[model samples]
Target: MGYNFSRFTRGIAPGSRIFAADGEPLSNDMLRAAVPSIFATEAHESRSARFAPVPTVTVLDGLRAEGFEPFSAVQARTRAEGFEPFSAVQARTRVEGKAEFTKHMVRLRHRSLTNTTGDSFEIVLVNANDGTSAYQMIPGFFRFVCENGLMTGETFSEVKVRHSGNAIGEVIEGAYRVLEDAPLVAEQVASWKAITLQDGERLALAESAHILRFPKADQDGEAPAPVQPEALLRPRRSADRATDLWTAFNVVQENTLKGGLTGRVRNAEGRLQRRTTREVAGIDQNRSLNRALWLLTQRMAELKSA
Candidate 1:
């Protein structure tokens, strides 16, 4: 029941009589007033997420054509709505200097499958620190000696570590350097193909991306690949070397002392009490021990430095 100036205007000027679809006269003033209420219902306050203000290109105008959106309508309309440019997202889509939402990291790491055997693969974020390693700047350091970096001259990379397998065998961590050669890489690629897998474990491996150059021993008829020392540069290999050195040195010292001295050698602490245990029943036990354990430990620690 809107008032019409023509009917109620007593004498307001006449133009079109605004009418409902049924042709009932509706006043022009009421139509003008209703537009505001309609717009109020529709123009909500959306959070602005761009470094630059989104162009007010009506609801239908294209961004680039209007010069308001970071990308043109053709571009933005094709991608997800939130798919802002990386730079724009970093600049404006912030929660205290960080994007509220962004791409996440996917990483490659080496895991020792067994004491003598091991494998490397990719793992999604598994630890808070791995989530923060880039900021920390320090390189990977973990127990079980994944690889000897410095000594072997191996380049380092992010490697998430965990102790599995009941850790019964030699505690070891393996480090890997990516190969640059296409064919060998292709071969290794074929090697990591899916094998039989146990429950709740991994079997397939993404191709190794680490590319390091080192010296390699001259081979026979086979085409000599990039001359880097693949085995020597491996962390496990270098750690093994340090370990072997430790063992050999201990063996020589043990044999020399065993034959040259009866039991305990006298030192500045002369004639220290040698509590000898006697197994009267010819007790026999076999033990394999590394003489260079400390040296290996030191060497391993140093290798990880690089």
Candidate 2:
């Protein structure tokens, strides 16, 4: 139940930082400091001439024009090796230069859908000027209770725009496409909230999520998972203690990604050592795991109804 909120606030990648708006639209200055990649004017130099550079800022401006206000932003850190480690200033310069071209994600809320109660849908934008990623938009849910941003299942279509011609126009269209699907996502959440899980079902859900976070080598493998499956069902806050499918999904998702549970693991010396799970800090891994968990819960709901 004791969750480390700081770890969640820290950016998804190493050396990265996250900036969230405090009841106001995030300023360009703040975003530039936290996610310089968002403002990159050109692609990485390694990119070939055929690789057209679609600056993320251009798409972001286009989204803003469509009334989508960015609330949070984060960028992955890319380090250049073989730098002069002795000079701290040079190392800092190398990191800053690479940061401008790395991958970044921004969470935006439509002005029309902004509210102060319950969960609301968000447009999650991911892109990179370095050709590591295309301009992708996914539907996200912002839970007010825990301030968690959850990526929806594959039921909500993801929009991707290549860096070629009219990329900005495509991205803006994609944002609206996600916006149009918000009602369906809301209906899904409502259904989840209405469906309550029995104790066994909750445990089953936890077990499945555990396997996802810590897969076994084989049935005969001696090494056990660092944490028990049941542990993930423990809610960080009292409000999330319900047995409803939505609550169960959020609890498991948070526990799996923001791992801090203690358990025992066999070390290289063949002795049991106390170990704690680390958070899923990679941008792509976070998105994939979140989507997988959502799909798992959706399947469970279908089975329960059948």
Candidate 3:
């Protein structure tokens, strides 16, 4: 759960990890080897490409040439009977290791000054391949103290590249955008930091976020009992104890997405039952949460502006 966040919080230098101390790319053979679906020889009968299918290797090679190196990789496993052989995998490589993953999501940060204090702008890239998802890059932030990975719900900052002949080119172009948006991103962060929430507003945000992330809880005319709103306010890490809007937002974000925060509700029998929420693991949940958080952040920003 803390795998991605811990690494990012440590601020692992891209140059340090991407290359050996002697200055060469670290062994990405391990990363490359994990994603055989992209290199599989057998054709996927269901997915016919308009152009020749671009090998994942080709995309990685192109990114590498541009100074990015692969650090982490993940692939979706297919359980359906016919789609057994077809799977989509995504590897995250970074420009000098500025991005860190929180449960497979990377926060791309941009800073204008070498010694600037306070928060910077960030984008979150969830390099995913469910065999259907376009390569998605969304704006996000990484909090140094709390080690939270936040997907800023700024729609204009989002970039997507379809799995086509131009996929690699599109991806490279998007990467450049990350570097270019430092000022705008940093400004947004400043706005979020300036906005502090009262306890009522914080809890209301949590309740709304609960429904937003877990709409299934409200299905079938029998809504799942709500989790204690305060539970969402509990910090996953000690560093996150601040009372500002950013900290308040992360409390909800982490609880909703990382799971294991306990909550209870009435069962069909009208008996109380407790369940520990799990991190959002499914690709669909991931996407939904990404969008939801982005929207929530925007709302907070607006509220602050108001």
Best by TM-score: 2
Candidate 2 local lDDT, 1-306, one digit each (tens): 111111244334343555464658776777777777788888788778877777878877877887888877766545456433322211122334666788777888888886665777888888887777888998888876776678888988799988888888888888889899889988898898999999999999999999887776224745677788988898889998888998999899888887778888676688988977767656676777788888999999999888
Model 1 C-alpha lDDT per residue in residues 1-306, reported as the tens digit of each score: 001100111111122112233312223243333211111111112323222211122211221132211100000001224444322211121222212121111111222211232221221111111111111010211112221101101132323333223221111122122212223422322332322222111100000100111012133433222222121212222333322322222222222111111233233345543322111110000000111222233343344333
State each model's CA lDDT, in order. Answer: 0.19, 0.75, 0.52
Better of 1 and 2 by TM-score: 2
How far does residue 217 in candidate 3 sit from its true spot (Å)? 2.7
Candidate scoring better on TM-score of 1 and 3: 3
Q: List the candidates' TM-scores in order.
A: 0.14, 0.87, 0.71
Best by lDDT: 2
- lDDT by residue (86-156, candidate 3, tens digit) is 21221222122112211133333332321245343444444433234456666555444443345555555
Question: What residue runs in model 1 are displaced by over 4 Å at the alpha carbon?
Answer: 1-100, 103-141, 144-306
- The TM-score between candidate 2 and the true structure equals 0.87
Angstrom error at residue 228, model 1: 42
For residue 109, give model 1's deviation from the true position in Å: 3.9
User: TM-score-based ranking, best first?
Assistant: 2, 3, 1
